[model samples]
Target chain A: MGITKTQIFNEEQNDLAQFFKVLGHPARVAILQYVSNQNACICNDLVEEIGLAQATISQHLKELKSIGLLNGEIEGKKMCYCINVERWETIQNQLNNFFNKTKSNCC
Target chain B: MGITKTQIFNEEQNDLAQFFKVLGHPARVAILQYVSNQNACICNDLVEEIGLAQATISQHLKELKSIGLLNGEIEGKKMCYCINVERWETIQNQLNNFFNKTKSNCC
Candidate 1:
């Protein structure tokens, strides 16, 4: 959507849309799933796991980080990444609220 | 993502991503919320409610319908739309499963 279009909707709508937009890509979704499934922070393995180029994976990681869904730290030479649990739960609740409040009115 | 890139991910990942991609816009989210909030199916009120042009709203509606999130019918000269209850529940559960199964592995 255009920048001016976002002003019409409320904050919650824009926020939720941002989250959804970030996760709209399959690579991003795959990256989140792989990172979440790990027992420790992942570094330098996304390219192999997601079968994408390093640059592509980094771009996807950037998108995920932009939405606060990821936490990253430089461990010596590598940047390790993990899920941001608090943000994850908050997003989960927000989505749940959206689903719960919007009753189905099929005609 | 490119058409060829979608083949790299499994069906579930692709399907879920498609759902998120369709919902990435606030206008579509607002449309779903507005239609779901009503007791009856809505027809021709989206323009005033979402503050977008008729063509834009129609395009968004088309995207939502493509993902099976909405059901539309030609009612006289106007098209009425409502949430697809079964598809909605399925998507909600799919999202819940994705959130639940992907445990937080914050570093």
Candidate 2:
């Protein structure tokens, strides 16, 4: 893959693309949906809930957390995870802004 | 990379992920923005406008078109490109639905 010329784009474009890139994988999307659907923080349930291996789930969770979309904590032997609500809202608004501002004008 | 377990995910999850994956690249996002900002179809200008090589720009355009976000046609010598308005609206709604339905309940 060619190196991305991220420097050529503004902050909003780069930031928005990063968010979308992290969410590009189905495992990450499924993980986000599962965690967000829960009433409280979840621990060690993702492997069973998403039907992926523990390491695989951890990798997906790591990707989501890298973007600050998921908040996680270590509780003894288990690591608990939940949505980072503020970050979620911020990303939602960012996406909305991109879509709203870039309304197409041509055929 | 492990093969994505697409079968484990529902249609919505797979569809949304594909959209996000295509938009994940900054070059693609820039291409879409440039095309949408234009009042008419753009042709041969993307290489200059996006500061990418002709081949690189074409690849990115292909990815955008693969997701149905871009409409393109050959205008004699130059290939004209524009946003697919219907597909854009549908994707916007899909993103909004995913965000709305998966409202975070914790942390």
Candidate 3:
């Protein structure tokens, strides 16, 4: 296999790509949507809500948290999860800017 | 590895998941950004602009086209590409709705 040679890309390109890469998983998307729907911090219910195994959901949660999109607070033996609103708004604006910028350009 | 059994999820869940999955690749993200930046219909410059091999860029283009994010017009041996405005707006609204809905829900 040939090496990707990702070094040729700019940091902004790579950073933006990494952000999208985290969003690429179906399980993660479902988890995010579910969490978004929940609105309040959720604990122990993701497995039931998302229909994935606990391990799978946990892994997805970890990915979301890694991106700072989700936050968790330990309440006893369970961890309550909710969207980090500040990060959510940041991401939304970033995406909106990216998409809106496209509208002005044509070729 | 166990089978994912995606059949268990709702159609809306699956559709939304597929959209994000398509957005997950760095190459695809770069392609979208490049196309957005170009503003004019880009034909053969991608290999130069993004600095990926022809086949690699072609594969990435196919993925974006598959998702209806890009439109291509074949001119002789080359294909000119641009973002499809209507579909772009549709996807933007869908994503906006998904995120906005999350803000309204709790627990």
Candidate 4:
């Protein structure tokens, strides 16, 4: 949603929606997967691995970083990126709790 | 993407995108959280719980169910909805794998 429509939602709802919205792109997912598989901080290999332009990958990286899912540190002219383990665990726990609730009294 | 732009993306990417896209809405998130917090299948209480109209809640429910995240069972004039545990686990695993990759050589 744009700015106005989002005002109707509570803070938590908006935060959760913003998190999911950032994941709505496949390129982002692929980028996250690529980073996750590496098992170490990465620097500038997305263009070759993802078959996307440097600018596109950079944009996706920016989005992930904005959400605190991917952490980055500047080294020379390049930026090194890795998953934020604590944030990842928090997200995992939040989502797991949501899914773990079983149906006790369905319709 | 509407129709044509989606073609540029692979099948797995598109499927994952679809799943995240369905979750991009705050109303949907609220509904999911509500359902999860209930710990049971719920039918027709969304209007009261979510403060939305019946049509709006129904539309959101349909979107969630369409993505296979929520399962519904018919009972009389109502529909009882609960989380699809198997699919939820699959989604969790897929996302976990994506996040588990450590950055090997980021830019």
Candidate 5:
């Protein structure tokens, strides 16, 4: 968790928690959904869509990118951002594995 | 996004965010795992298993319970906790719906 006690748990648990941590904010969820629904990646559109300032939107985008949940490129004068499909699926699998592993018949 | 903007996002996104927020901690993840793998339930075992103090483990357990991912019962002197199957299935479906909604082809 901190510096010395990180090794007790395996990598998968840590990675899954990180993904969830990045997704803990509503703004990030809105950003991801807006990007996912668009035919093309929307950069500036998010500022308007989420009703947040440009800087706040950029901060959320950066957090999403930190988890590899998104990718962006400079398109003409602006940057276009979209979901990282491979990473999304990777996270999907990770979450699926975690949820599916629970037998849950005990209580 | 703040006091005036809570209505901007729908209910599902908010609920999803809450779940992610609770699961953001590795200690909580470990606690859930330890509870899930047992046949009955483990309350005090977690203190030893996680190697954390009693108060620390209780705090994590409270967070997990608040999210409805766990259920506990007062069994004599100690309490026994286990995964809430119906709620687990509910959250599993929620995560699945969120993930499966993404078309994710055009990155």
Candidate 6:
């Protein structure tokens, strides 16, 4: 397929789409859930918690980080990861705005 | 990229991922916004409004329909589409629950 004609859409539309796209994978969703449930940000626990290969989990983690939904820090030999709350709140607001503002139904 | 290990994840994770995946495109976002803003459901107007190719818009509509986010009804010569409120509310709640429930800051 040709590249998405992003210019045709507004900034909010593009931003909302990006927020949704980052959460589009089951592995990523499970990873965020796992990290959020823990009292401390996690490192090596993800591969076991999510039941995915280390490489796969790492790739998912990378995608999550690339989108600013997740943050990672090197802790000696391991990298600890956690949800980036600031970005999460921004995404939540965008999502709520989209869902809550659509009024007067059709069809 | 290998296939996603969907079997490893729970039903809720899969469902949430599906909701986001369907909305991951700017064109679809614009289409939903356009249809919601209109007083009546729409069809061909999307191609012009979204400024995308007919096939691209049709594909986006199909994906939205697949996830129950949109509904289309054939009217005489045109197929009108609109946001599906029931599914929209469900997704909205799911997103809210995910965002609201995550607490306890982590670095």
DockQ of each: 0.72, 0.76, 0.53, 0.44, 0.56, 0.73
TM-score of 3: 0.87
Q: Which stretches of candidate 1 lie over 4 Å from their true place?
A: A1-4, B1-4
Candidate 4, residues A1-107, lDDT tens digits: the string is: 23325666798778767777888888887777777767456557888877777987888899999988888988788777887778877776655554455322333
Q: Candidate 2: where is the Cα deviation over 4 Å?
A: none
Best by DockQ: 2
- Candidate 3 Cα outliers beyond 4 Å, as residue runs: A1-5, A105-107, B2-4, B104-107
On the 0 to 100 scale, the lDDT of residue A39 in model 3 is 41
How does candidate 2 fare on TM-score?
0.94
Cα lDDT of model 2 by residue, A1-107, tens digit: 65778998888779889999999999888888888787767556888878988888888888999999888888777778888788888999999888877765667
Would you list the C-alpha lDDT of every candidate in the order shown? 0.85, 0.84, 0.75, 0.73, 0.80, 0.82
What value of lDDT does candidate 3 attain over all alpha carbons? 0.75
Candidates ranked, most accurate by lDDT first:
1, 2, 6, 5, 3, 4
TM-score of 4: 0.76
Q: What is the TM-score of each candidate against the true structure?
A: 0.94, 0.94, 0.87, 0.76, 0.90, 0.93
- Per residue, candidate 1 scores C-alpha lDDT tens digits across A2-32 of 4648889999999989988988888888888
Model 6 residue A101 distance off true place after TM-score fit, in angstroms: 1.8
**Total clashing pairs for each candidate:** 0, 0, 9, 15, 0, 0
**Winner by lDDT:** 1
**Model 5 off-target regions past 4 Å?**
A1-8, B1-7, B103-105
How would you encode candidate 6's per-residue C-alpha lDDT over B4-54 as one tens digit per residue? 778988898999898898888888888777888888674577787777778
Better of 3 and 5 by DockQ: 5
lDDT of 1 at B67: 89
